[model samples]
Target: MKFAVFFLATFLVASQCHGGSFRSFPLEMPTGYGDGVSHDDVRCASWRLAVEAQNIFGFETIPEQCVDSTAAYIEGGQYQSDSKTVNQQVFFYASDLKIQDNDVVIFNVDGTVLSNIPYYSQHGYGSEKFNSTRYDEEFVNKGDAPALPETLKNYNKLLGLGVKIIFLTGRLTDKKAVTEANLRKAGFHTWEKLILKEPSNGQNTLEYKSTERGKLVQQGYRIIANVADQWSSLKGGNQGLRSFKLPNPLYFIE
Candidate 1:
């Protein structure tokens, strides 16, 4: 009887250590196919990164990557291409703009979602006009766009906690001023890194970003997490980066 009791106690302790609470969540990509983003869902890639960082390291919140027209636009409605495997027409229509001043919308299109046609809509800087050359500027700015208040709030909280914050994106780099104005309008402030895409440096764009993330890792700055709409970005990041994603129905190009 005594031996059995002791073994039972040991088993219970071991079980707890290996259970959900004891282990990290299985590394899975964010769900793409959904009715759309729900306020309470809290499952976007960016949000996932933030949550993981908070849980693992004592970080405050997750950072975000905001793409702009220059990055999405390929040739002024000529069909902007993404680095993801899927081919998509990315556009952000003004009609899709906020009907209410504070109205917010979340896009989610992945599995079982529509396969073809443009995914997102935009104003003047349509995906058609997207040019990779614009990112030549060292400092890329972010612009104000409709965003989830929750995301901004969490990012702010993280910053307030003394965590160094940075921004990364495949957006064109030259339009830093416009991007900055947009981000401010969207309620973001004082970001550290605003990484943007540059002309292909002989390597595939996907490989380039992956290499960069590795370099950042070697710099001794522990990457707590990464959030993005695409899988390539998630895969390219450091092993320590907790990845989170949101709904991105559009296609991914590289």
Candidate 2:
């Protein structure tokens, strides 16, 4: 993703015009992970809790078909969108947030990073289909390269630290299972959360996850931090949520 000042300006202006609302309130990253008794340590506990929740109940394991489909889209070509400028900006912004193994990133499909899903959708691929079917043995057996290998590896380290790993995305249901499978095959040893887009019945998957997380938080699990390249993740007024703002290199959402 390439960065352009013009696109950034446009994104800000467009967001204002659209009256977009984000929930996350940014907090400074603690100097370091401190002892569990310190204030920073409490924050770390919260973050760790969020990560663990993702590992335990995020989504089912990913299937091989999703992995192949994702790879095919990347190897094929990018599909152009009307908001080309902002998409490019988000891509570039997200790149700066990439800290090579230190940061735990929840990449936004529509904003932080663009996936092959769009390309496949445009090309009449089977990715648009969904059913009760989840990731299966057939999909796993025919796998190629994982869809997001590097991202998965970075999260894996967090898992090794006893920190929970998650992949919080707003992907369509059809692609959600496959994406999870790809991460699993790529050596992400933890069961990552796959946040899917809401269905036509007016369900908000993110909201549900947020509610579920609140329960965890009340149970004494605090979210240490969450990093994303887009404003979408911060739709509420919660200040304890930690976020890293980076330019969106890929022009995704307007």
Can you write out model 1's per-residue Cα lDDT over 70-128, one digit (the tens) per residue? 22333333222222212111111212222322211111111111111222343222223
- Candidates' lDDT values, in order? 0.38, 0.38
Cα displacement (angstroms), candidate 1, residue 96, comes to 38
TM-score of 1: 0.44
Model 2 lowest lDDT segment of ten: 5-14
* TM-score of candidate 2 versus the correct structure, residues matched by position: 0.41
Q: Can you tell me which runs of candidate 2 are displaced by over 4 Å? A: 1-150, 200-220, 237-241, 252-254
After superposition on all CA atoms, how large is the RMSD of candidate 2?
17.6
Model 2 per-residue lDDT tens digits across residues 91-170:
34444443333223344433233233333344333323332233223232233334333344434444544454445555
lDDT of 2: 0.38
